[model samples]
Target: MNHNYKGFFSIVLLAWVDADYKFMWIDVGGLGSQSDAQIYNQLELKECLEDGSIGLPPPSPLPNDDQDFPYFLLGDDAFGLRAYLMKPCSGRTLTREELIANYRISRARRVVENAFGILAHRWRVLLSTMQQMPLTVQVIIESCVCLHNFIRIRNPAIQNIQLDNEDGAHNHVPGLWRQDDNLQDVDMPKEGNRDTVAATRQRDYLKYYFNSPVGLVPWHDRMVGV
Candidate 1:
């Protein structure tokens, strides 16, 4: 396997998590040399999402609205945009609506971030170099995920203190996991593929929806400093 951008042999753990920070789907053992976009592009989950074979819910109207919207996954700029997947709008000069949309996506992505954070903080083994063979390391990682999900399901409060919280104004408060250096984020490539037409349209629609009367949250304008 190739060494990652960090110049060390590593494995990429691709995970899809829910709002509660539980893993919905995970693919482990990709060589770390690949960028996140590269690894994700090859995932079966991505294929399923694209082909609409993964049994996702159908498009539905947002609350108090007649306009229907497709269910989509929120990802960072590291991932490609798709009708089923939404990422932050990129660029330094963005509109107020675009900035609010980006802020919303960032807040949602924290579920994934804190999920990995709690996983690494509790299972400290992931934080260090494993001397074991690649196969063994894979099993160790899978086992940790299983146990992590089980604990979350059985006793949801097990890692409450480890999660990120929000203040009365909805400002983010970093979780305890952020204070630790156990798990570092995967390196993103400097460039991404051009957004597909459908993806661009969907993102634009969301930008409009998020700023509209129905989708607007009271704190959104304040959060984005609009």
Candidate 2:
């Protein structure tokens, strides 16, 4: 069970889930030590976009009339920022605007986290580490995810059953940051190297949008301490 990347046995599961908690895609064979950004970059999402298989809406016209609103994947700071993928604003000293943007993005990204939580809660196999070989573990993980989606599809009302109490609280309050025990922080590249000029502009535009009246929630300022 030794992995070439980390010199120990480990397997990474990269997954994409929809709002309904249905798994859209799952990649279970990556090295455990690989970064989220690395795994995400290797996904076929970009290729699909190029082939027009994925049709994303243009950029928000309310925020930037001239810019196309590129639909993006929400990710934590462990992932790199891109025009098609967004990570939270990083820094110890963030402006009020930046804080709001981070909160909103984090809020949106919680669906993925909730999907994982529900999967682990319902499937005890995921609750404990698997001692099987990498390939076996990969199969188990993929099977569980697929089964999870199948169950949800057959019983859509199961989605209403809250598996995690914290999910309820956070869903109601948009800007609260919850610390996940399973996630380990990884240092991202410096801002200068993280994104292209267009990506930065796109993020800035979204930041403004979040702080504006259109995107602003009543408790946003208080939650973000803005």
Candidate 3:
């Protein structure tokens, strides 16, 4: 089996969504071989984070009042752990606390997936592979995403598109994790492979928050099966 297959060229589509599942920013470029972290590093997100222009709400008063709670982006294992970008804990032998953290993060991350599904459903052009040049394809994808956001804003009813249950092959939840064409492994420095001390402390703070009265969800334990 030849693992170096590069038959079909592809472009990475990086998008950010709000809690309401609307596209806030979308970057369409980069080769399909690029990992999520690589593509993300090329974006202006770092600048935004530094400038404090993301409009994050003030932190709520949690049990741990010492640590500052900043807004963050939720990503999967393919991405690295950063102060602003959080990924689930790797490996299967996770503690109960880790399981809860993963579940909460996954639930929050589903917003991006839901946004993609809604875009594809509204704009049929994204349903199949584009035959046009990479640049042209990027334009088409961008246009579709922009239009999707436009329609979402003007027509609020379009937001509730029966995503919970469907028939046949589409029966799964609209936002469930699905393999993307651009998925690839990310090579991290051995020393930096682990989450940074600040990131880990922040994650631990959130874990405590999730189990506390302020952030506790009554059914979270049963749902996560921990």
Candidate 4:
């Protein structure tokens, strides 16, 4: 992604469970530091999302499932994500379905937002100007995200987020993942645990407490019928 220096630089790719919290997804254009890690090469992103290094849930769930879920990717105008989303997805379009799906996914993917919010509030760099050169900007931004995740784990918030044994599939809980307890300093695990096949999914859940805004263009086209 060639970030428009005169315009919006490549935003940091952020994915999180939303306030409502359902199925998770990430967005782009928050901070751009880690863009390289995200595979700036278009072919690479496609290949990665298709048959590559990582597996996303719902669209790429654990071994045993009969249904294949269509990925309802969302983002702001930046990220250029609409193109990624517009490609023929599943059985195809229906009125309000995309919005409905977006709502559900956004709910699940809000953790990153809160996490980012916390990071920005903590570091104050995110609140600073994006006018900086792309290279410098991306480094600072990514470093901060890595730091934020680290701190959250090292000093967990008082209430442990006891995930429901079920993946909140049917009962999508909103804004409940964050606990109200005060955070105390502790040594949180640096590397994520890989206990079961489900552990990969668990790591996904833990990744990106904050992120880029998923595009709204898909919804926009749906609404305007462009």
Q: Which ranges in model 4 have alpha carbons more than 4 Å from their true place?
A: 1-43, 53-99, 130-134, 158-226
Best by lDDT: 1
Model 2 regions lying over 4 Å from their true place: 1-8, 46-53, 57-68, 163-193
Q: What lDDT is reached at residue 209 by model 2?
A: 84
Q: 29-75 in candidate 1: lDDT tens per residue? A: 88877877888888888888989999989899978889888999988
For model 2, residues 54-144, the per-residue Cα lDDT tens digits are: 8777656544345457777776665556787777888899999999999888777778776776676667687465888777888899888
Candidates in order: C-alpha RMSD to true structure: 1.6, 4.8, 6.0, 14.0
What is the C-alpha local distance difference test score of candidate 3?
0.67
Highest-scoring model, TM-score: 1
Each candidate: what lDDT?
0.85, 0.68, 0.67, 0.39
Q: Summing lDDT over every window of 10 consecutive residues in candidate 4, give the lowest-scoring window.
A: 185-194
Task: Indicate the residue-level lDDT of 138 in model 2.
Answer: 83
* Alpha-carbon TM-score of each model against the true structure: 0.94, 0.77, 0.77, 0.40
Q: What are the clashing pairs of model 2?
A: 58-69, 59-68, 59-69
Q: Which 10 consecutive positions of candidate 1 have the poorest summed lDDT? A: 182-191
- Candidate closer to the true structure by lDDT (higher is better), 1 or 4: 1
Count backbone clashes in candidate 4: 30
lDDT of 3 by residue, 30-131 (tens): 666665566666678756764677776675554545555776778776656767778777786988878887887877776666677667666666656678
Q: Write the per-residue lDDT of candidate 4 for residues 1-226, one digit (tens) a residue.
A: 4443334444544443333322133434443333322333343444565463445454643223333333434432223333122211122464343444444344443444455445555565666556777667767766766666665557645212422222323443433322323221211112121133443233223221111134232333333333
